[model samples]
Target: MTRTTTVRIAMNGVTGRMGYRQHLLRSILALRDQGGLDLGDGTVLWPEPVLLGRREHALREIAERHGLEHVSTDLDAVLADPDVDIYFDAQVTAAREEAVRKAIAAGKHVYTEKPTATGLDGALALARLAREKGVRHGVVQDKLFLPGLLKLKRLIDGGFFGRILSVRGEFGYWVFEGDWQQAQRPSWNYRAEDGGGIVVDMFPHWEYVLHELFGRVTSVQALTATHVPRRWDEHGKPYTATADDAAYGIFELDGGAVAQINSSWAVRVHRDELVEFQVDGTQGSAVAGLRECRVQHRSATPKPVWNPDLPATERFRDQWQRVPDNGEFDNGFKAQWELFLRHVYAGAPYRWDLLAGARGVQLAELGLKSAAEGRRLAVPEIAL
Candidate 1:
């Protein structure tokens, strides 16, 4: 009989939104509820997570709510616990580096949300540290796990598209205008010092998706804007918006595939999740959204010439077909958490590593530089 390895994880920042979703509710409680899960290969075991945080009251509340008895405000205490085999960081971006360093020092495997650090250099340093410590490390590239994106990946891997051409990503949602006692959605997401901003927050997701679907980016040109300057906080206090609300960028991939990404918090979107990516290739085309995948291919019957003035008709509208769901739908974040646990426990190959995360920061940095300089910037070669 194969021995089951029980991995105990220390979940830092269990109080935050992503933290709660990825670590607590999904990673910890879900496993407990499911009586443990099996990775596809049947070799790895599920994980048990111990929630750690900075606020005792909040930590206790979370623990009580989840029926988790293991909760603490002292990170050092968690690290010192020999039973904690993996250190997961879901803290705010500014505090991530320090937390990760401590976790590495504690001889624990590490996983964290994207933009692993504030900038490229910090990300690289952490990557180096993980290697030096000889510990496994990973980052949340949840977008790659999205059903829509995964379908896209399958098509790409299967060569459904003859030769890749270009990709376009649209991501946004109209954030509430903070006024008249309206609570601010998330304060940390709007402050530069706190690692707020659509570019830094969302680009890491896109970078991995694009790289996985197409290839690594060779260069980028971008423009950014802060559309809303101020907003009301949860306590009815006003705070100045210090981060970019919108970012538009064009990326050149290693194989010459071009990608365009747009991220915004100011636009109202009709789509449920306000996220979609379209890929056009030599022999086929596909568009994917939160819960939908539409495809058009050369094998399909050909139609008359496309007319500019034509209304919605069979030639255009019928060209696309929606792909059906294969199983129950779960949040992409949750799916990634489950996968990460399986990887750490079972020796499953983790696709999203620190190098992938660093490339994300590299893209964002280049985008910022390009936007500031009013010119395109070639992405520097990263040592993988």
Candidate 2:
């Protein structure tokens, strides 16, 4: 057996929600708590995360909470530390490029949250820089790690879904208006200047899923809207909604498979959680949520249509069978964090690379363009 590699990691943006949850607490501390991670397929190791931030107090609090010994407010200082091998970025979208560039210059591997930058060019540039520096680079497309989505991928791969015809993805929830006594959500996520919006923020997940399950998106037609023009902050302060709240997009893929994605911050869902992807194929259809998978096949099709005017005899409802949970499930974000660490330490091939992320940004840009021009837009060819 090969001895495990010991990795020293510098976690940037350790104070934010995803940063705190995935990078610091779950990926670092949780893995340590579980002794060591077994990254299936023979990779077994652990990562040592040194939290980094710009605020001293926040960093101290986070470090102390995690019982971590190393924490720094200065990014350059953290990057310069010889002990740090990987720099993890969970910062807001706008700050990602600069921080990642610095990490590449410092000769450290990088794993960051998606939509690498505000545009595809920036994402490609970072990919180029990382290659030039000979460092591993990856972007989080955590949706792929969701057990439900993974099941969907398995089905697609296994030919359980013969010739997948279409996919419908529903993503979002009612974001608290930040009014009254509610604390304001991240300010950056609501302002276009800050790289905030449903389209740019969530399309990366869709991009990877579409690529993984079906094929690359060739073109797109979309419409985006800001349902609530103005919102109130935690302290009853008024703020303008500079970014879109909802987007509906159609993605045309390579093999005649079409995907329709709907992302919103204003819709309510009753049947399941906000995020779901349903695939309909010639052989069968599957609906997958964040935690569960259900299947309905041609063999189980309803025998007849029931009418209220006659005795009801519909049997299709019973044919839908629930697939059991495979095992312990990690939150999507945390799962990707573990994968990133394993990839960095064991040289595991990470599928969600910069090229995939750039494709996502390209889709978002094209989606907006399509919406503005009222025409389908070809996904711009990106230089990997």
Candidate 3:
């Protein structure tokens, strides 16, 4: 048995929806139970998450339920502690930047959720601050670690997509109208005042996905809408929906491949998965969702004549073959957390840094800009 090295983290947002469920309960605590991650040199890494929040009772309850002994309502006091190895932020999108800046000042390694800041400049500032302070910083890019995407990556690497042509993405489901049924997402997701909108919320994910899977995003043109203007709140109170519920986007990639991504909370699912991408190339095409990936090779490709004169009889759905799951797929959040822990505990390097996070914010910002200005905007590279 190797020695377990403890990495104490001051978790500032453990009381929030994502923080408690994904980071604390699933990632950190689960890692602790699995004997932590092995550090290649007969050593193990143990994550110690100290819950910090505005609500003492909620924080205490989470700590107790999760078998953590440390809980605090005072964030500043907790961050000031020298024992805390890392400062993590999964707080509300509006409240993240200040706490992260404070963590950088305190010389702690930092990890945070996406859209590192509300604006692109603020996100870039955080990147610069981390570099100046010489601290390791990372943001959650959990989707890249998904099993379906991983399989898609394999096909791309294998030249299954010989000369990629275009990419089409469909994401979202019908979030219930609170008048009749409970909404699937939090009410804040539809409010602009609370830093919520479809473009800002979903475009960040699309940016990284397209950039990683295909190539760098050279340009973007988007159209957004606020469908279903009225909605009931958590307390059954009616409120005006201020933010956009849908975003239709076209992105020009590095290789001149055009990617069309449509994200909407108002649309009903008619595709194979809740989120799916169908990539077409000179050789073949593949569609990948969160868990499953399907492919159509050129050899197995189907051809049919289009005619409006007769009734359709082609079963287009049966043409593609299923992609195999090579191995067990762990929770994407947990997988990213493990990699982050390894990077912190050992001297291992991780490519997804604050700079990458800033790019995501840039896409969201530019997507909204394009929507408003009714023009295509170029995505200039941000040098670190």
Mind sharing the TM-score for model 1?
0.91
Clashing pairs in 2: none
List all candidate RMSDs to the true structure.
Answer: 2.6, 2.6, 1.2
- Alpha-carbon error at 34 in model 3, in Å? 0.7
Q: What lDDT does the true structure give each of the candidates?
A: 0.81, 0.81, 0.90
Candidate 2 lDDT, 1-384, residue by residue in tens: 545556788888889988887767766777778876786666567678788878889988877876788878889988888979989898888898899889999999888887888887788888888888889888888778788988877777788878889999898877777775463367557788889988888777787788877998888989999987787755678899899889999999988999998998877776576688889999999999887889988787566765779876554546788877767777777777777776776677787777777888888878878888999988756775
Candidate 3, overall lDDT? 0.90
Query: Between 1 and 3, whose lDDT is larger?
Result: 3
Ten contiguous residues with the weakest lDDT in model 2: 179-188
lDDT against true structure, model 2: 0.81
Q: Tell me the TM-score of model 2.
A: 0.92
Clashes of each: 0, 0, 0
Better of 2 and 3 by lDDT: 3
Clashes of 3: 0
lDDT of 3 by residue, 1-384 (tens): 688788899998888788988888889988888988788898988888888889999998887776789988788898789899899999878888899999998899999998899899999999999999999999999889889899999999999999999999999999987988999877888899998898888888888888898999999999999998998888898899999999999999999899999999999999878999999999999999999999998988878888999887877878788999989988899998878877877767897889999999999999999999999999999977
TM-score of each: 0.91, 0.92, 0.97
